[model samples]
Target: MGRHSRKGAEAIRPDAAAADPAGRPDVPRPSGGRRRRQGPVPPADGYTPFQDAPQVRGGHPEQREPGGGWGTGPQPRHETTGGQQRSYAYGSAPGAPDQDAAREQAVARQVSAQQAAQHAADGRTARQPAADPGAMPGPRREFVDAFDADPPTPVGTPEARSGAGAAGPPVEPEEAPDGEPAERREAKGGKGRTFTGIAAAAVTTVLAVVVAGQVAEDSAGRGAVARAAGVDRDGSEGASRSDARPTPEHAVTRAPEVKPLSYGEKMAQPYPIAADLKATGKFEAVPGLAKAPGKGQKYRYRIDVEKGLSLDAGLFAEAVQKTLNDDRSWAHNGAMTFERISSGSPDFVITLASPGTTGEWCAKSGLDTTIDNVSCDSAATDRVMINAYRWAQGSATFGPKLLLPYRQMLINHEVGHRLGYNHVSCRTPGALAPVMQQQTKSLDIDGIKCKPNPWVHPGS
Candidate 1:
């Protein structure tokens, strides 16, 4: 039979190597009189204790129960010597005393020398006091024992070196030739930095001044320059804030004064016209109004003139208003009032025209005023016509002596007809005639003669 054949007891389980890491198939278990269970044989080359054996990473052995039959061989290496312990990992072989111990002692000696030298240098410096002289730490334990195990995890790297070096004494500052600190010697370069800063500040100030001058020139413009040079827009210096202004009296212009005519002058100055001069049929109303002067049943009347009449229309208007509104006339004792208007439909239009125009207008209402060349109230229409010839000349009855009363009586007699009154006669002979009497042609009626009257209530 071939030597490689397995017995029934050799089950070739996955944990066979864990039961016996030595890979010695013929070796017996420590149990009494029983053949040892074998593990799979290992390759001759690249053989290691942990390969195919149940072990932890980093070359550490797994803990096994005491009831297992695998404790007879040498124990795999752990992190210790016969009586010493180490914090580093993965060193040379276990129990090899000479080279590993000698190398560790040399490393400890070199670290201790470096710490002693640093302590001596700290003592000689005057600027730095020795730190905690009583509790001064000895040579660092980490650096002294850094190489004792050489574990798979690295040690004494730059990070480990800094942590281990922190417990040591401080290094000394470099000294100047005069025993002053090297930092004091370095202050010579600070003077250059300060000079550079001052020069930059001066440049900044000069630039700021230049910018301000440009801004002022732009803001002031040519007008400000001209003012500062004492010159005006005409290039002359004559006008200034201190120049005197013209006086109020000389600066202002006064209108010429006019004197108004008295009542006598307006009534006496007559405008002459022919007794038979006909004109254009068109009429123009005077443009004004005189409001009633009393609280009574008011009658509004208008003044209209034939287009070519030569008499004073203003005088005629004034005469009619004064005669009617008088206390002795239609408005006596505020019984009634009369207002004259120039527009809209009035109660009556007192019109002045030539005798021919008067005849023409009166004929429209079927009246025969042409027989005596007198005036009439065209009652069916809006006009009460007065003869302009008689207005300009005095009648023979009233004469020039009472020319004003004759004019007033003429307006009243005709306008009274417009007020709904018929011709009335004076009952008393030689007394004032009733204003409704036909005083313009004659004052005689039924052989009774009356003086001229111009008012409804003459005594008032």
Candidate 2:
């Protein structure tokens, strides 16, 4: 039995030497191809099993089984070394270190710190904290202080640098004379203010030219307006006459020759009177003269009839007085006043005469009465003559229905002539003829037809 046991021990020795390159006599050998349970063994001097070593990653020691293998060892406990507490995980070796991994980690950390410093200098990020807390922050703080103290440079411009190996004090950039930004001057090609001033001056000049043109046009317009309002006395266009003129003669001694007229010829006629009227060719004044009721220039007038006239003088005078005193008359609104005077030398005379006598009297006043039976307000004779022929026979232009209104119009027309009004034509067709229009001659004149109107104020 002793010899057999010695041979079995000697036979397992080679297997154990083959399993472990380093000679270890404490390792139990397996019997019948099964592993054996053994008691915990102390590490050899300067050597430890791979399963008992510590593991490290990124400078921090990790709690892991050594060599990634499981072990049933005594639980580790806290220990104090160099006054610092250290903890070891279960199944870790007590005296083994991975020097190559630690050295490689140290080299990687150094390369990372150098890259971080370079990034900080290039302004990519803020400076990183040192791996060792006790390391001084002097160089980083100094760089930050210098950067904060420097004056800010304008964007899009290079920062001003100091000399080769020395850092100088920060300098403030000079301002432009106009207090404008350097970038703004560069953007506008250095002509911003000059261009603005030129544009403003151009706008002012344009406004001045427009204003001058308006003033010139207004001056010319005023001159034209003034000229258009002026009129002359000889029935011709002329300039304004603000000066007074001499009084006209009241009568004329010589009369122009009369051109004979045939019957049925159209003559501009006067107020109509009865056919059986008689005349004596001498004047007799209308009686019962009184001041007319109005508020304007007073004009005393006399109504005269020929001595041989068969007409009722009292009736004629009454009709004339009523017509002139009407509300719509030319004498209304205080424009003028008229009264009949039997004794005094009147302002003018209204005479009812025969056709032959009317021609002689109108000719003496420089009117062309030879054209036949027409009335006239002659400035030379100061007389408003009503032809008896037209008084008996109304004008061919007016129908019998308009005879009475025509008589009133005749009275207003001759009176208007004496009031310094010249003849005017109708302005609009179908409108009332103005008092100054020669309505008795023809209501349709200059291609404008008008209705007969006896009163000057048609609305009134």
All candidates: TM-score: 0.43, 0.39
Off by over 4 Å in 2: 1-279
TM-score computed on alpha carbons, candidate 2: 0.39
Residue pairs with clashing backbones, model 1: 89-150, 89-151, 90-150, 90-151, 91-149
State the RMSD for candidate 1: 26.2
**What is the model-wide C-alpha lDDT for candidate 1?**
0.63
Model 1 agreement with the true structure over 1-460: per-residue lDDT tens digits: 0012234443343455766788544343343332333433333343334322323356545543322231111112333222222122122233232232333333454456544544443343345455576442333334323323122312423122333324331111233334554334333323333344445544655777677778878867877878876787787984665457665887678787787887656775556788778988788999888988889999999998989876778888989998888888778889888998988889888899888888988999999887777889897788999988888886888877777777877877787788889988888899988888888778888889988887788887
Ten residues in a row with the worst lDDT in model 2?
Answer: 156-165
Best by lDDT: 1
User: Which one is best on TM-score?
Assistant: 1
lDDT of 2 by residue, 1-460 (tens): 0001223343333346656778654354333432343333333243333443332335333343222221211223233322222333343333333122332333354345444444444452245454466432233334443432313432221112112112321111122334554234333422333344345544655777677789989988876765676643344667445336544577445687886643222122233555444455788788887678887788888988877665557766766776777778877777877788887788889887876677778888788754746788767896799876665566666665556666777788888788888988888999988888876678898889988787888797
Estimate the overall C-alpha local distance difference test score of candidate 2.
0.57
